[model samples]
Target chain A: MPFPQFLFPNSKFPSQVRNIFLFIRRYFNLLLFLFLQGFSIYLIVHNSRYHNAIFGSITNQLTGKVNEQFSRVEYYFQLKKTNDSLVKANAKLYNKLKADFELPDTTSNIFVDSLKVDSIETYRKYNYYPAKVVYNSVAAQNNYLVLSRGTAQQVRSGMGVIDPNGSVVGVVTDVSKDFAVVMSLLHKDSHIEGMLLKATRKQAHSAGMAWRPISLTFPGYRKVRKWLWETASYQVATVPAYQKV
Target chain B: MNTLVKNIVRFALFILVQVYVLDKIHLHQMVTPYIYFLFILWMPFRMKRTWQMLVAFALGFTLDSFHHNPGFHAAACVLIAYIRPFLVNLLIPQEGADTNYEEPSFKSMGGFLPYFIFTGVLTLIHHGWLFLLEAWQFGNIWYFIFKTLLSTAVSLVLIVVTELLFARKQSFRTNTA
Candidate 1:
């Protein structure tokens, strides 16, 4: 006539049923805690494929939107820095322009202008696309940078990223609808090929002509150019003025 | 109702700070402070155990979404949530006398020492679990331990400073109760 007996009329384990009910009631919180923990572990173990396909996209979209909004506020604070970098980049580009270099001392050397302007189009090798960095980090072991450009802007994985001053930043690893994640050069796994210019005695002595190539692997090479330039300048300064023919 | 509103606002603020601000600060490779776990540490003591775990899970999941790691934060959050009651009960002997204390804080947990120990232990445990899971290997046990300790120290300092700066006074708690 008891509830457990009535529910299990054909069974002889009514006491076991009652005990099970008591156990569930006594440890309901533990049961719920275990369930939540188990679910989270399941998510972690299956995160690469199953979770990414279903929940990852949705959360990515939400987080991307929120990060984009937050980055707008951050962008204001970084306006001066960004502008400074841009101006420096502009000056560097202007210095490289053909107009910047006049007929270099025509009296000392004969110069011939035989190249056609229309033929310059065939020499283009690389295309540049500018994207705003919505999020970036340099402190983590595996650093990543998020850009505002994505598939909609033709940003895809395997594309190399560069800063305004033509320095290598990273490579795009993942792209969503409106955002892309770049694996920064600072990342542990990022290896880039770079040429080390060794200024030999002969080259260093010659003013404005010190470029000798030595191949090297550049991992986090942001300061290599500056450091090498400084050393080369020091070498040049130490050389006697009589060496400058 | 007021407490509920306050908690909701706290949730939003914690998430924003964790994702937008703390996550951006590149202090060091080994000293990434994760004070968001403080949300679980500061939840109302009288809250139902189930609700506490649920809220912790939600907080962790939201952080994981931003971090691009599906369940690391969620697992750590739930573990801390489950152990919090036991930790509080173990530390605070006179819980019945201080029923007016809405949540764990510098003022509620008696004084500075007990509060620091309480939050410090929780932060250590949370960081250990989270970092271990992130490493997912015993190959570099020393590196993992160093990272856990460094991060725990930073997070504990941030937690204590936040409590000192923004934690409501005990007088406010008495009035609310």
Candidate 2:
């Protein structure tokens, strides 16, 4: 059986050079294939939950930057669609703000007749802080979202983040001066207090929430604050400038 | 000039479509169609395997960066790129192999069947390896297989449709020169 000549069709070069070329030609595919496969396996093996979170954030930042640029370009094409959605969102926001200030039409009729007054104090529990999502990853075992608003914008680590349609997104986990990390509900370790609307019962996406008391009674709460201020002075000091003033 | 511009546009389009669009489409909460690998699939046949693998790695890494899944895509893509030449040798007819086939499309490959089979098999391999790495520690064997198959099917359909819709018709006889 004749050896294949395609590996070294031209033999004009020196013997050593030709031999090296022949050797590379013979084992190039296997060598490179194994090396890449091994590298990939290494990546897979090292991708623990911790690494996943860290890597996820890094990629999220990079992709977010690219997506932002792409979105800017795409924004021009979908101006009409975007305008419609913005109008709808604005309408919804208007309705919500209106409901907070104005009395019902039925209440006006009652006011015209006899003096019928009610003292129900209807107040908003949560203030919506609109933040741009700089990075969001949904395809990992543990998902996270990075938002532009952080401690500088009065965004705390415990704030509940929501989607445009008012679906629960996640709670803020970590916050820097200018950015915050949200542990999305899609994460493996994410366990939130969710009640099914129709069933009116708690549902666990993961394990049930275990309440670990960082502060229990009033006295303990004071102690916790004192400890936090002492230990986390650097973080506390970086509070929004307005708050300090 | 045309080829360079076309590939450049395709690279951007695939990355955008995959990361922004297809990656988000969790069909029935299982399928994530990766049409970006079509970039690698549609590469010139005469391109070296080494270069192909390198391009494949870049493609996978870029995607991994976006999807937040580390090396899974890269590994699977490299494996497919490695096997691509062998698969081509096995599938490409003797006469067709002698004749230069620039792109792997239905018209260029002489018919739809070979192209479909090639794309489908490779897509299955790529998805299977990727999902395996992703679900490495999971207990459900059936679910892994299900996800791989469903994803492969979806990717295959999307790739074929994209090729049919976008690929230019090439006459192999005229291009023989």
Candidate 3:
């Protein structure tokens, strides 16, 4: 039976059942393609709510995995600076303790200087858990930093990341079994609460919104601070100065 | 049937790859690659021109949903698909291209000349239009050119490599007079 029979009335096969059936089948395939493609475009133009939900959670999980793998690589590279920041941070807390008259000075009993840490707390008991950067995306428009710590490690979302110098880095976004994603200071998406050291006030984004943070991204703000501090050393990201975990 | 199934698989795979892998390759807050349009390039040669443009748009929208610049890739893809049939006809001679003509294939499309010329031109147009849509400002005009070339080069490499290794065993489907 020759295909494409019913469409044209000028058929010569005497309209056999087999030929008519074949014609239907051929047209059906083409029709199905048209219907499906039209439906696809309809779904697109209408911005159907169904497809949107499917992607958000799927990519979130994938982004989490990708961020994890990347942070592991970056964590390895930043190990040395992480260690030095830890030691220096430790010594800083120690001097503050002695100045509070809680420790008997051995060398000179000159542990008496009015520092902000002392003002914030007579004994500032801040604990940092040292976790590697499991995923670090310095290039994403909405970059995130994932750590090797999670809820199991007592790390919660919104916990501020501090550098060795006790500066702010980012906040915990997602928490897994033993992994957490940090929305880094460099993340164009994140604008966490931060303050200037010298003025001790928050330097808002050029838009002048402190709480409702916009993209006043501090790409080189920390470096500028490091230079201002008379330290031509290096700059750090989300985990601020010497506060290591 | 096997080739049809293979093409289906390739289409799905290409979309997944563009969304999962390529869109993540942003640099300096720019550099969006328009490689997803390669799906349009691999369509059956004799497919209707209008359908080709329509499918190109679907492919583009799928990727755009996963990207920052929504509708940018979709619009560019439509332009490419619109120009594709004319471009393909221009590059390949219509006479000897017989039944079961493999689309843009090295064997059926008369070796690499027509295939590369057609695909390369369409891809550049797609990428160029896409970049312009995303970045219309003149402040970073130099960067835009670099981005367009970079994206076009990457997409072209992907297209050529895909055609060489993964192109389906298309039969002579072109209905010639």
True contacts kept of each: 0.58, 0.53, 0.03
In model 2, residue pairs whose N, Cα or C atoms come closer than 3 Å (at least 3 residues apart or on different chains), thus clashing, are none
Best by TM-score: 1
Model 2 DockQ reads 0.33
Residue A86 alpha-carbon offset, candidate 1, angstroms: 1.7
Among these predictions, the greatest DockQ belongs to 1
Mind giving the per-residue lDDT tens digits that candidate 3 earns over A1-245?
A: 14544665555446576676666666754454455445434444343112233443344344455556655665677789888888998897887675567555543422233454454334333467777664455443334555667677887666777556655556665555566666655543354433333343465322111211112254665554444233212322223322334
Tens digits of per-residue lDDT for model 2 on A43-158?
76776343355555556556656766655665587789768867877887777564676566343332142323543434333456788776676655557776776677887666
What TM-scores do the predictions have?
Answer: 0.71, 0.63, 0.52
Give the clash count for each candidate.
0, 0, 30
Candidate ranking (TM-score, best to worst)? 1, 2, 3
Clashing residue pairs found in predicted model 1: none
Q: What is the per-residue lDDT of model 3 for residues B66-106, given as tens digits with 9 covering 90 to 100? A: 43223556777777777776776676766657345756667
Model 1 per-residue lDDT at B80? 92
Off by over 4 Å in 2: A1-25, A51-60, A69-130, A134-142, A149-182, A189-245, B95-99, B171-177
Q: In candidate 3, residue A66 scores what lDDT?
A: 55
Candidate 2, after superposition: displacement of residue A68 in Å? Answer: 2.4
lDDT of each: 0.71, 0.66, 0.57
Ranking by DockQ: 1, 2, 3
Writing each residue's lDDT as its tens digit, candidate 1 over B19-99 gives: 788988878767887888888987888798889999999999998877665788899899999999988887774746347
